[model samples]
Target: MKDNFSGHSDSYSKFRPGYRSELISYLVSLTKRQQCAWDCGTGNGQLAVKLAAYFDEVYATDLSENQLRNATPKNNIQYRTEQAEKTSFDASQFDLITVAQAIHWFDFDAFYAEVRRTLREDGVLAIVGYALLQVDESTDKVIQKLYSDIVGPYWDPERKYIEDLYKTIPFPFHEEKTPVFHDEYQWTLEQLMGYLETWSAVKHYMRDRGENPITLISETLKQSWEGFDTKTVTFPIMLRVGRL
Candidate 1:
């Protein structure tokens, strides 16, 4: 897996949106047991903290120690710095395995091998993520230009999986149908900028140019965002659940 967010782990933990309760409840309902869960590539423990409430134990692992350091603490949750493709977990340990917004970075074959080895017979593997955020048409137009024109070439190849909505990703399991879900937030323009700053492509652009690209679109975004102290931002959730 790639370690893209470690440098701005603090910003990640603060600005990234959490999974909605409806989505969490739905995942919990699919499990036959709530004994334990493994959240792989669990950046900042966002999904791990949620699983903690439903399971006896939740083990969240990430390749970035900086991200793990800022993870939210829960009594039943254990955060570790580990790769997604391999782990020290025992066989048939987890009742459910979850990868939230991080599976695109994994070596799928290797990760699936570990999933098959560690997941119980009835365990479900849930891969979840969200599409690009949507706001008003005017703001969205400016944002789209920034995404496609400004930093388009900077995005990693793995981003194609997300753009395809995970439909084309390798999944060798019995797939389950899932309901449509979304994450909605009331955020200010500054909050939106903070979230955009967390994008890996933006980080890559800054690295190569020695300048933050967000500055280029700031004034336009401010003008587009005028008249609203807080705007409704919606992220359409994409989920793929399966069993080995």
Candidate 2:
């Protein structure tokens, strides 16, 4: 199924967590000098702008035009509307490449080939994704249940693909798992519901069922958020970085 991200671009940019500055700094230092880089599936140009800040140029590509339009970065970052698997970058032209939270939605075989083609010898390839907020057992119990019972089913397809991460992908990347990072957010019940509705699962479910997931998720989260403070929430994040 086509990933429907256009509708949630605004929320994603606002709410979705970004890679750490430490990680970004590491990405810049990988080549040991400024060089050309590509930020594939660069949703809203978050990492692309960072890549451009150090690299000579950054080719930031995404399938979502609205995300490109919404990004405002101060760097030599060129935005393109292209799918990750079918980008038209010159072969062996990049010194570094990164994908943030988007590898799950790609044709891995084609993407890996593209990475191999575009990256210079010993070029860095960083493919990373983070844990979802309120999607864990250690956090609020209600939040965990909501994710498992409500969002889990719809997200299973993509989640299953990501399970093998660096193991299944045959790219020449050195893999390292980051120490889990945590984030805290202050949200009202309504705000929490809004976040839930922005999830791919909820959006896709809404499309298929022809019902307001907003209303449903809101009601459900409201009933569930009683024990926990809706205003204060903590989210633990786990990230796996595959670097070449």
Candidate 3:
């Protein structure tokens, strides 16, 4: 289960993404029994640990033990190394289920069936996903080139959403986008490099070609920024949900 992320633990933990409180509040409001929630694909348990503060219990599961190691040692968070397609929890066990940046890696049909079997009738299933990044027009031009020209071809087609495709799946579902606000995080050159190194597309590209992505990324970042400080990089995230 933990095979894919076997050796990238440090890159993942230090440079992984996180969610906003606004998204969390919205998810809680949708659930009647916010007392118990299950955080599916709980990478590093960032969102789940925060959720534990809002709920009496949280069952945050992931296939990667590398991720679970950073789950903050929370007593309220029942961390488990369970695949989304094959979790051990009983039917209607959770009042809410949150899937953050990791849903793109799921087996949708199997995952949906499990969600159907596990969530309470009124439970909310908030699925969140982030994109390459957002920045000012000048900065965005460079990022856009990187996304479309350099990085786009290598993305896992199995992972990316084929617009409106999930709607065709046989699950009772509803879709909603979070507030259209950008999240800005400041990054030093090294910190920014670390973030890019964590991207699976970049990792796979280098692996498939037997080239070092970090070296290229470092060279590119240096060339692009004249005198870079901790400038902001905004990322947009969207969430869709429904009761099963």
What would the per-residue lDDT of candidate 2 be over residues 150-228, giving only the tens digit for each residue?
A: 5567664766545554345445567655554555767766666656666787777677788855564455556666666
Question: Candidate 1 versus the native: TM-score?
Answer: 0.99
Candidates' RMSD to native? 0.5, 3.3, 2.7
Q: Cα lDDT for residue 138, model 1? A: 94
Clashes of each: 0, 0, 0
Candidate 1: stretches off by over 4 Å: none
lDDT of 1 at 46: 94
Off by over 4 Å in 3: 1-3, 162-171, 174-178
lDDT (0 to 1) per candidate: 0.95, 0.70, 0.73
**Each prediction's TM-score against the native?**
0.99, 0.81, 0.87
lDDT of 1 at 99: 96
lDDT of 3: 0.73
Error of 2 at 224 (Å): 5.9
Clashes of 2: 0
- The prediction achieving the highest TM-score against the true structure is 1
Write the residue-wise lDDT of candidate 1 on 165-198 in tens digits.
9898899999999999999999999999999999
